[model samples]
Target: MKTDILKFQNLNPEKETQISNLFKQLGGEKKQIPLKEVLEEGNHITLAYCEHNDQVVGIASMCAYHVISGKKGWIEDVVVDEQFRGQGIGRKLMEKLLEEGKKKKLTEILLFTEAHRIPAIKLYGDLGFKLKESRIYTLKMP
Candidate 1:
């Protein structure tokens, strides 16, 4: 399968629908991202997608920011279609994110993965990500 990494730009409704499905494959709740707003506004959010035969098969996003120390990039929402898994699509998506980080001169990149996602964890390790002994906290706002 031929795969190409695409940086999201000038998105339309059709591509938006495909991205919604891709997120579902990652077990994310189905919701539409405000693509136009995101692209038009400078929020430092970048989305990379893996396309095969003009169809999106995988996606990954990065939120980069300037910190007191320096610039940092956080990877999020990486997922490949079930049928396309193990074909290096996810890896390509991540490579795109890394390339973006490099271009932005990010001081560090970080991501969190579930412990049960063994394959994903292995992939992250191969990409030179090390497990940091840090606690994660979250809260849902009403």
Candidate 2:
């Protein structure tokens, strides 16, 4: 499968649609991200995706931030179409994210995946991510 990584300058309507579809595959529901959010560039966000035959088959995104400690990259929303899994597309997406991290000079990269996602956990491990002994807490506002 051919994996064409998208350049920010090349983003357009059609490609955005493909990306939204890929996110649906990840979230298991139709919750389209606004173009405004997807287009956040500079130090805030960078997105990477693999396109095959006019369709986005895999995608990953990162948020770059600078705390008092150091600059960091947080990986998020990684997903590959079920039919396209095991073809190294997910790996490619991750490599793209890491490559971006390097370009951004991030001090560290972090990601969180569900414990049940065994394959994803293994992939993250193979990519040199260690299991950090920490708890994730969340709160929703009404």
Candidate 3:
């Protein structure tokens, strides 16, 4: 599989559409967000892969933030097409994110996967992430 990492600015219309379609196929309620939102947010990066036939087989995103200790990034929305899993595409996406974070001088990159997502957890650990012993709390708004 041919894979490449592209910044939002470098994404063409076809690639953008591919990304939107991929998100929906992965069960995202929404299709696509405006490019302006991505840029204005200033910390999020989207990575995509294109196969030889020009189909996007994978997509991943990360949001970076600054804290007192240092800059940190959070991985989000990682998805590989069901047909394309187990080909190392997901790992490539993560490698791209890590490289981007390093380029931006981030001190850490964090991610969370559900307990049932054992494959994802293993992938993260193989990429040098450790499971935090601390508890996580969430508050949903109406």
Candidate 4:
């Protein structure tokens, strides 16, 4: 059977609850921030889908930043409904984000995925991302 289509659009601030639900389904640990806070931060972009039944099925968020070398973008959270995983929805979402990054003249884009997520790593590699041979360290501040 043909899968329903996927479309990308800017997140509607009013749909924050739905966005939070999607993130929760994906096992994200971050607290849900208000949409107004996201807009005020001026760095994040959240993309969502409108399924055939007019329901939302996926969400992806990115943040753009300027570094000493040039502009860069980071993919923060990307989740497709569990029922929709095998469809091309995730790929389309990522393509849309990359296109936006390119339009803004970003020099690089980066994201991190757990080592066990081989499919995701393959997808990123197919889209021309390289595996950086370096360690990533993080510290949480209270």
| Predicted candidate 2 versus true structure: per-residue lDDT over 45-72, tens digit per residue | 7777787777778888888899999999
Q: Using TM-score as the measure, which candidate wins?
A: 1
Instruction: Give the alpha carbon lDDT tens digit for every residue of 1-142 in model 1.
Output: 4434333455878877788778887774535566665555567888888777777888888899998988999998899999889999888888888998999999999999999999999999999999999999988666
The weakest ten consecutive residues by lDDT in model 3 span 39-48
Worst 10 residues of 1 by lDDT: 1-10
Q: Candidate 3 — which residues are off by over 4 angstroms?
A: 28-32, 39-43, 46-52
Q: Looking at model 2, which ten-residue stretch has the lowest summed lDDT?
A: 27-36
Clashes found in each candidate (C-alpha, N, C closer than 3 A) = 0, 0, 0, 0
lDDT by residue (tens digit), candidate 4, 1-142? 2222222334464455666677777674677676556655353554434353555567676678888989988886777778777787778778878888887789999898888878778888988999888898999779
* Greater-TM-score candidate between 3 and 4: 3
List the candidates' TM-scores in order. Answer: 0.89, 0.88, 0.82, 0.82
RMSD of each: 2.0, 2.1, 2.5, 4.0
Tens digits of per-residue lDDT, candidate 3, 5-93, equal 66656667887777777777667354567654664535466554545478888888888888998899988778888888888888988
| Model 1 misplaced stretches (Cα beyond 4 Å) | 1-9, 28-32
Native-to-model Cα distance after best TM-score fit, residue 47 in candidate 3, in Å: 3.1
The lDDT per prediction is: 0.82, 0.82, 0.77, 0.69
What RMSD does model 2 have?
Answer: 2.1
